[model samples]
Target: MRIIILFLFFIAVGVGAFSQTPKKKVGADNRAVPTKNKIQSQMNEATSGIAKEIADLEEQLKTETDEETIKNLKEQIGMLKKQLKMMQGLNKNVSNMSNKVIQQAFNSETSEIPKRDVNRINSLPKKILNDGELFVFMKQTTQEVENKLAIEGKKLGMQLFDTLKARKYSAQAMGQYAFACMAGGFPEMGLYIYGKACLADMNNADNLNNYAAYLTMAGGEQYSIPILDNLNSKYPFNSTILNNLGQAWFGLGDMNKAKKNLEDAVRIYSIHSRANETLCLIQQSEGQTQQATES
Candidate 1:
């Protein structure tokens, strides 16, 4: 009887130990969560692939080929070179990490962001010294505005506005700062920045599109329409551009035109959040009117 009791106790202890053990969470690839090492490994693998492609393209160039095909291959090689540079830019500290690991870190700190400081805003430079300063300042202010801290977004936006006016910066940077203004609840300033960005870089499709959309929002539909039309003509199949054009039409109270562009946006990218939200708003408004008439 004593032996039997001891055996039973051992069995119960074993079961409890098993229950306390942690399980490995398998992701879609049926593996444990990725680590920095995994990210580094993936980057290395991509680098190897790019190198292989470059070699193969060189071989193709050596072979007899048509002029057009040769030009395309050269362009592809150039693109691969750019990718190689970008891959090499990965920091040594994070070189070993996987995207999942980075994402996890980002998620952990998402809510720990500090609030905006009014004193800092009040004493900020009247004009950013350079594009790099502009970028860093915008990054610092982005979280503040997004968190909706005590500081007014307009104040930060005005600083960007002044910076653009007082100093020279890249067109891309100008467009980005302008977007910050728009998000900070200063649509007028955003439009001005967008205009400057577009003027500086007419070939910048992004700035042109954003400027047109802001113009529409600011009740400059007549000015924005032509620009949107020109973009549509240029990028007939780009979903984001189409969505912006639709938004411009919506601002003009042209439901039919808005629906057409918005529909095209959905067809191009089913998961487009902005296009879906606009469609829902239109539907809800029409539904409410119909219900009111019925009552």
Candidate 2:
């Protein structure tokens, strides 16, 4: 019956809502049981109940044109589709948050990520889709490479290098490749990837920033000095690039200029960790450690 189907739908939704924690968060509760997974199991049960009811309605209704039966079936199908979409979205969020946690862990410990999450990330298909979804997936996968993930990230990127060999390139995809290259500690490769994207779209700031970022990261202050100067010339008041420039100046022992660039950078991006840290260092150098402490 239509009324019975509706009741089952509400029950499934209720279960999904309660079992909202990600699969990776198991053993996170005081009860030593993951509440979310329990709820997910319940949802699976309720989904089975809906399937049974739908099957019963289909068998009992003789004609496809029976308006009530047709309408009920359509509603059931729609509900299933919506739930699938919700699940996929939840999967993406979970993957992203897990990647962040892993990055922080690496920063503190300087070690490899667990093989499980690494294998899970690597399992994403190498083939990029046309719907612009592939970029997000690739980006998520690349995040596994904290400073410690350099080698694994290289392997993952190289796995798909063959896929693009004969394929027509897009700036969007190449930009993502640039990201992977940078994270993997291949600045030359990173610049090469960004260069391909820039060749496709010369004025793309995303590509330009990556180019600048790798230059700074690779050669320390020497190469970064000229690059940052040029970048600041264009985006004079841009905090992100300026912050980078300050660090370069510091590396070159240009204390006065480092202090200036860092001051402007922190002014523009008040809460930026790198900029604030660099600025604090410069202040300490200036015999103003007290001022840096206040900051």
Candidate 3:
């Protein structure tokens, strides 16, 4: 329910920045090796700094009197705590692994679409609905699909998936089918399809964004962050990417980053409803009543 689904139909030009290859250093034997200990030390320092900041913020909270200041202090403390927790988790989980191994582990966890789901989706009978028609159907009936029309929506989603598969699963076709599956309430299927769509069209911004959004919605904030960060670097000032980054940060309980990105998104595009709504929610939570109302 907290998912921020920002499905865009328009295609943008760019290479998919899904995974970044870690820079390697050549050893005496001319073999590339990852600097695992260096990275771990850096992480340790970051976590320690964040822990200190949280302690400072908590101490500030104890003496804060003004309602707004108090709220801001609490949010900062909460965000710092969450960030510290995440850093600690990373350190605990991957501290001993080489950078190459860590990257491989991350990619394996995030990128693989389930083979069984893909086969089942491909096995459904192909429907005659074109992309435009499918989009229209999903747009008009998403709410209904969530309620009384659930059965019909699921069937339609399956058919759409099969249709795309039969068409050789072009990036555009795969994206549309993924959207249909999402709108039709088949989230697991949709997520897998989104992964495939992203792989099929690594350069397609919409496909990557949708995949990242689904990951965040499914509680994979750590995984989504890298994808969103890559997109943000490639497409600076993009409202959709910024909004998604905000959502992912929020999911990780990094209120400060969430607010900053959501605010940036709203500033870049005033009419971005999702960005505006999320920014307003953050403001409201922080007791910025006037700002929330204005937003």
Ranking by lDDT: 3, 1, 2
Task: Show the lowest summed lDDT stretch of 10 residues, model 1.
Answer: 7-16
- Inter-residue clash pairs, candidate 3: 16-202
Residue 165 lDDT in candidate 2: 38
- Look at candidate 1 and give me any clashing residue pairs: 36-96, 36-97, 37-96, 39-97
lDDT of model 1 at residue 252?
59
Candidate number of the best lDDT: 3
Candidate 3 per-residue lDDT over residues 146-217, each given as its tens digit = 343346434444444454566476886577546544533356546555665665566665676666676666
Residues 1-295, model 1: lDDT tens digits: 2221111111111111212212321112211123355445544654665567678777888994699878766765665565456555642545555555554452231112123333433443544224344334434433333344233434444444454555566787677556433433344445555665666666565666566555544445545556656656655655555666676666656666666897787676655545555655555555655522322
Model 2 C-alpha lDDT versus the unseen true structure:
0.44
Model 3 score (lDDT): 0.53
Better of 1 and 2 by lDDT: 1
Q: Tens digits of per-residue lDDT for model 2 on 135-183?
A: 3432432342223335643443343333333345466556654543333
Off by over 4 Å in 3: 1-167
Residue 220, model 1: lDDT of: 51
